[model samples]
Target: MTRWTQAAVLARMRQEIEASAPDPGDRLPTERALAAAIGCSRQTLRAALARLEAEGEIWRRHGQGTFRGRAPLGHPVRETVRLQAATPEQLMQARLLIEPAIAAEAARRASRSDAQYLLRLVEDGRVATSRGGAEEADARFHRGVAEVAANPILIGLLDHLADARRRAAWQREWDRTYRRIGVGEFVGLHSDQHQSVVTGIAEGNADVAEQAMRAHLLTIATAMRRGSDPADPGL
Candidate 1:
């Protein structure tokens, strides 16, 4: 039997995460199972896992076993194979259907700390220096709302939507839309909308939060549809 040191066990655990749960937020094998597979004592395996958790390479919940990924947004990724290939139009439709409800739930569920975190994300977008930075802040703000909702399933859904938003088809459409609207739209219009949602959430007003989220998404839809009229080419 091989005697695995703690460092060796840690390395093996990382290998297992990379090999088996390649996606961030995917769950890992149970501790007992991992110990057996790595040929290490449970003590050594436990030590290795603690190191990973401390480093934010993984996270654990009380009844939920260990999972791959960092401190925040540790919800497991859902199987979204078909959605990944969905058209940009369909993705926006799905977001319209679900995201408002998620925002309402965030308002209902958010603690003071959660609300503060969301404000930070909103501020990050407002102060962003570049288009790419603003887009990233926008993504984090949306995901941060789902995190405040305190539901793993909803967070996973948002994660998939976020992933779909990154597809090349979505990027092409978004870039065209953004070129028309420019960074000013991000700094002015979208940031104001995001601030409204955060305010509603902070005030614990579910209806306001829901309505604000829908309005924000609709504004994006309007932007996307702007140039579709070939005669106007609204750009």
Candidate 2:
């Protein structure tokens, strides 16, 4: 079989394996059985199996055969929360909850270099926004927050959330809203909030840091709600 056809067959097999049992430790069908099922020669099947093993999706035991591999660690959510599926509304809600707290923690724990990193993020955001580089700036800002938090768990969670939020659907919706509604001003406001939180932390004012963080998040939530439903008039 051609290389492309072998790759396609491998992908299909992988999808089937995933759909059948997503959990790790599940046994995969034998190579001969899979080859027969897919109507592919053993050579093509072996090539596909090698690829899957290299990708860490499966492991072959010299004596026993191939088994499913462990899934990569992912963000943990103990309960259902707003925006878990990465809709625009959900992404904003997640940011409102996580980013401010990250800022507050940074303010309480950040070293001088941490503070400088944040300032640099703000500066980058300004330049990027001006140069129509909002997406890159946005990512940098969030990554800076994760760095400042200095907690591996929080960093991992934020990284996963950021990844999900960057999906095409969410980006399209976010860009549409920003373009249609002149919402880019929030970029500067976000920078200011970050600075305020960093200042509070650098000054060793834990109370100020916490309060500023909470207020900043609430403001984001309120703004998102208002923008989502401008006709509410109550906003």
For lDDT, the strongest prediction is 1
After best superposition, candidate 1 residue 107: deviation in angstroms? 0.9
Each candidate structure's TM-score, on Cα atoms with residue i matched to residue i, is 0.65, 0.54
lDDT of 1 by residue, 107-214 (tens): 999899999999889889988878899999999999999999988999888888887777555777788888888888897899999999999999999999999999
In candidate 1, residue 140 scores what lDDT?
93
Q: All models: lDDT?
A: 0.82, 0.64
Error of 2 at 166 (Å): 1.3
Candidate 1 residue runs with Cα over 4 Å from true position = 1-81, 233-235
Looking at model 1, the pairs that clash are none
Please, what are the lDDT tens digits per residue for candidate 2 over residues 1-235? 3434866888777876786535454556777788767777888888888888898887665545566773223433321122222356667677767776776777677788877777787777665544257556756766776787789988877777776665544555555446534435556676577567667767756667667767766765565556556475543
**Colliding residue pairs in candidate 2:** 83-90, 107-201
Clashes of 2: 2
